[model samples]
Target: MESFADLSHFLRSHRLRTAPAETGVSTGAGPRTAPCLLPAELARAAGLDADRYADIEDGRAGRVSLSVLHALASALHLDADDRAELFRLGASPGTSRLRGLGHLTRAVPMLPVIAFNHRYDITGWNLPGQALLAWDLDWPVEHVQPNLARMLFLGRATRALYGNGNAHGQRQVAGLVGALRRAVEQHPDEELTRLVVELAAGSREFAELWARPAEERSDEDDCGVLFRFEHPAVGLMELSRVVLEEGAQNGEWAVVFSPEPGSASAAALDDLLARVSGRPC
Candidate 1:
């Protein structure tokens, strides 16, 4: 796996790799080659002070405004996707009332659903959903919030639970990092920041993937995915997952898994559901 550096390191590295000529800065006559701009020079081009710009990369300057972020993007010559990612990093995780709720779960007819916020915090899981994943929901264990990323990386039974464990684990980790890296950059002050910081410091896998550039991670436009769960009791369960975002923009998403029609996996799922529910009340 390729290990990646944080935004600060990434920005610094890109800046070094870019030539002065590319940004329309002139290099003094040397037969050798044109050089990259120093931090000071680049900052000047961005119309920002060197210290403030450094703070932007490090995420120290709180709540970077749109104008300033755009200026930096323009100065860095970031493309459309890069600009979108940069914007996500700069945006705030709008105030959400996710933590205080007694239960974060939601009910959808004839489907197994789990709810989570943009930060990947697993808020709720339907009984069928729980039967599929088979993990306890005890959260904020000594201040560490229970989220999907933690389970995938730290849980003992997590890998065994997945039919395609190793590959899926890596893919999930990568996707989680891609989602989270932007969040940390966005609201490095909120409760979720604690989760991100702790995971980054504690989990090497999480850290390495989080450092990967956005383009290297999963596509943000992907509507859903296909997953297979190797449940201990049920054997195998395959389903297509679609993330249904609540209209409120509160960052909550309902993850629903739909079993395929006339598939063995679907039959197994039906049997498992019946065994668990025992003739629905």
Candidate 2:
């Protein structure tokens, strides 16, 4: 079981980025400080034993106390939002009591929108959404709904959609893997377990990448980031992905792709969508 990997990474990176003076810690004479506190120093500041803090940093700590978390947050001068993220990251895996999604209940026609449940299951997508991502609308109704991780790591269509093994495609795939890692650590569902096992069995890339700790994976946005995809129909196009989350705990995140306006990419999308709309069902 993973234990606060995200929290630890955030802590360590924040520590490194923070200067000694900022934290009211002294830099010893005769040499410039590295601008970060040692694990022992940080532990002392957070009122925890050195070894215990070391365990947390290395992800060996099984669980941590709220007092210690509060102490660390205070010591690090973390803001409310980051403190909340830290707590969420450090939370027990079983704490994910997510609600089931009913409907998307929202739409933005200027962008292609698709929503996913907590399990990262693709629950809903708009008309332009399918064409924008070049999805196969003819997938038989008998099959299970498509998932982002599986579609990215296991499907052959991903290559065509993302540019046939382009660097951008690989990065996008890795980011999705990271997001999946985050979800897996937060919730341990039998369905998710099966998905992981199935992907690991079939996809060497997924298996190898997933083996790495979440902290080591890129913490970049899985969506809502600008990226270029070489669409076979639209040619090279850049899109800004926006992810909007619904509900509180269930938090169904919808990803919206909007072509960058006043650019060739936008024009290409316009032409492509027109052609797609003209096609017969």
Query: Which consecutive 10 residues in model 2 have the weakest lDDT in total?
Result: 94-103
Q: For model 1, give the 10-residue run with minimal summed lDDT.
A: 136-145
Query: Each candidate's TM vs. the true structure?
Result: 0.52, 0.56
lDDT of 1 by residue, 1-281 (tens): 01112345556776887777667754446663436767766787788998998776665765666567657667777642344344444542331223312132322434566656667665445556655654333211111223676776566566556534368646655666776776666545467777777777887777777677785545432455777677767776777887666522665555678788899888888777776664221
lDDT of 2 at 266: 88
The per-model lDDT (C-alpha) reads 0.59, 0.63
Best by lDDT: 2
- Point out where model 2 deviates above 4 Å: 1-107, 139-143, 216-224, 279-281
Tens digits of per-residue lDDT for model 2, 106-135: 225435666565566655554456566544
**What are the clashing pairs of model 2?**
224-241
